[model samples]
Target chain A: MDPANRPLSPHLQIYRPQITSVLSIVHRISGAGLGLGSLVLAYWLISVAAGPEPFDFAQHLVGSPGGILLLIGWTFGLLFHFCNGIRHLFWDAGYGYELSTTYVSGWVVIVVSVALTVGIWLSVLIAKGTP
Target chain B: MSGRTSLRRVRDLGTARDGVHHWWVQRLTAVALVPLSIWFVTSIILLAGSDHARVTAWISNPIVAVFLMLTLIAMFYHLKLGLQVVIEDYIHAKPTKVACLLLNNFGNTVLALSCIFSVLKVAV
Candidate 1:
């Protein structure tokens, strides 16, 4: 096959953005983010098992400003991936394939993810008596 | 005559026929993760600010320990599958893609094993 004669598909630069496409991309990104974030989870569990000294150190690190930011990002990542994964499951089940329904579900995933994340953090704050 | 080339016929019979298996397993793991993740997040939130002994005591519960193990396995397996797809899509180089895929598998296994081990240590 001649290189010059090879067929090329439309690239991202030339493709129009749509909600479904954007959500699909974000789902992949958030999945990757959560994969890395699992390390933090592992660290917390391991530290706890090690002893109180390490557990307190881990807690302090997690409660620090930088750690808080990382946790926030991970929280959103987890929630977004979870919501979108459910949407994908619906698609797999042969539902929500219509263009309108796809768009609606995409928005629903975004809204639900944000609401859940905020709700979780709000409860945490209330429980801590810091709100 | 069939409207197919000889090369196409042979190519269709190639060895890498496991795509469906991967897809199915990924979906299965994703479904398993739904409840496990909810359980995990809620447990963490409820345990927040609790002392080490308290947290360990929670983990020591057989029910909690079992769920924790399930979560670790399902989460990492799903994660590996997701990252495998990402790597396969973006990494065009053959050697690099294969290397990344291997690393993803091994790395996730190590991470999951260490997590499950910790949980068991605390629980047991």
Candidate 2:
């Protein structure tokens, strides 16, 4: 039997998308998003150190509507990855393996991430006196 | 030991020997990021709309500089580890996989250095 010709496992279409599976995939996606987002963050930091002109330019770009949208999306990605990562830590510790607990923890991660994102944004807007 | 031939032993034991170390470091970085990220996000929000001088001054604080440096290092390294796993899992072609992994490592190091350098510029 040729190793290169071996049949692969079942494709994603074969399995129903459960919360556990969906969250699992989203974790990886969010992690990747954060990876890219880190570059943006680094650029911002570098610009700040460079001086007012570059800092203002970077600020202007991020303050724009599209940039704000991307920032918001990245915020969600950060929170999701953060929350789900804690869940993963629990699993790493050999807990949360039961079927019911797994589903509960998945939902908990989603809810907590959403709540935290909203809370942070609300506070930010309020602090800016625009909320 | 079971009576396995030398060829069998060599075949079974592939080239990967440090996978557990990778996993451990990934987890260690993750735990470190939890606190660092909280501080980072809160600081960013608070510093929003502030002038460059104010932001620079904030980063100049000794505690702030130390935390920022730590965050930058951990965040980029974690990002590299996470992306490496992602690329390894999804990329099937051998040549492409090696290329992506190399790029991942190199790109992360550059980004990390750039950020850390920026921090030091302000802090010092």
Candidate 3:
């Protein structure tokens, strides 16, 4: 088979940026991010089950500055993955077929994820009475 | 009048029927994940300050135990399907795709088994 002779779909590079495009890329990126993030969760579990010393060490790690950064990244990763998963679900259900609806949903995922992350942080602060 | 021959105009099967099956399963798994994942996340946060006994007891409860098992199965099952799609799209070679797909299942299964064991150990 002559591969060079095969017809090709229009290249994505030529298309102008669009919300759908961002959403499409982010969906995959966040999925990969969250996949890696699962390891942190597993580590946490092992620590918890191992006993006091391990648990305390795990806590300190999670509580340390570097750990906080990872936590923040993981939180956003989870939120982004969840939001995009919902968006994909909508598409699966046959909603958001129109370009406008697609864009709207894309923006909604972004906004909702931010709101959720903020809401979680707010709840944490309220619990600690720190913010 | 004799019936005329039915001429069915054939258009290209856009996106193919297999896609619908794939899309449907992905959505089904996604929907299944909603409540389970909420419980999973909230449980983790709640367990944040919980001691070993507290965590173990919570996990040991029959309802949580069963759902935790289901959660493991559903999560890895869902992950397998999602990763398979990525492999199919990005990796062109038939052998490579098959290898990746098989490796994905193997890795996910192993991961899921370990997590499930952890949960069961806590419960027991």
Candidate 4:
């Protein structure tokens, strides 16, 4: 047993929450979620190439209840990941180094991601004549 | 340059000692995604009511195929790095954290392979 391996530091719960920390966590969460969700995309692409029966099956899946939930979740994940990724880019650019800017961007990511998700679903509703 | 430094710049960041590799990659992917993602979304939109041949032909273009692969690959790689950090930060149990990290990488690899193969199969 090595000394370096012994006695680790306390985990995230111990740290007081902040905008940077929250977004950092959500960024990864949404990223992983979206990454997993890409399976649906792969299936759709392959089915598209395989022709109509396969494509129809894929469409049915997307139209199904569970599928719709997953689709909605994936959409939200994509929106959040995209928004947070942009905020991170600004941080990388060193423009949001200021704490106030950091907090503002964090809230912006949350609000905008939600907005984009609803806006998308709204369009879908309108297209379906359900709105 | 001195043997040590302070207030590290973006290009200089990495996992080691306040570095910026993750930061840079995230930014690079963000910039790359702007056009690539738009292209992707638009393709999907155009794909609405698209026939099988249309979808196949669209992706078969070498440029589109290459760029699409790049987009997915970058996305998964970026995701792996992001989740690795998340695991490191959040998981308190050493073995559990390591296991999760391994799972994360493995999952990404499998997904990437499936997606890439599916695209290539269509193209070829």
- Candidate with top lDDT is 2
Please compute and give the TM-score of the first chain of candidate 4 against the native first chain: 0.88
How well is each residue in A34-131 modelled by candidate 1, as lDDT tens digits? 88899989999899889999999999888777887788788889999999999999999899899988899999999999999899888887878751
Worst 10 residues of 4 chain B by lDDT: B1-10
Q: What is the lDDT of every predicted structure here?
A: 0.89, 0.90, 0.74, 0.76
Docking class of 3: acceptable
Over A1-131, each residue of candidate 4 has an lDDT whose tens digit, in order, gives: 79988987877778888778878877777777876677778778667767778988887777777887887798888888888787777765678888888888889989998997888777775665431
Candidate 3 structure, TM-score to reference = 0.80
Q: Once model 2 is optimally superposed onto the true structure by TM-score, how far is the C-alpha of residue A81 displaced, in angstroms? A: 0.5
lDDT of 4 at A125: 54
Taking all chains together, each candidate's TM-score versus the true structure is: 0.91, 0.91, 0.80, 0.75
Please identify which of the two predictions, 1 or 3, would achieve the higher TM-score against the true structure. Answer: 1
Q: Residue-wise lDDT of candidate 2 within A6-117, one digit each (tens)?
A: 9889879998899999999999999998888888998999999899999999999888778878888999999999999999999999999999999999999999999998
lDDT of 2 at A28: 93
Please give the DockQ score of every candidate, comma-separated: 0.73, 0.75, 0.31, 0.39
Candidate 2: where is the Cα deviation over 4 Å? Answer: A1-8, A129-131, B1-15
- For residue A2, model 3's alpha carbon misses the true position, in angstroms, by 7.4
Model 3 steric clash pairs: none
**Local accuracy of candidate 3 as per-residue lDDT tens digits, A1-131:** 69989988877887887788877887777776666666666676666567667877777777676876776677776777788788777776678889888788888889988888778767765675541
Q: What is the lDDT of residue B60 in candidate 3?
A: 79
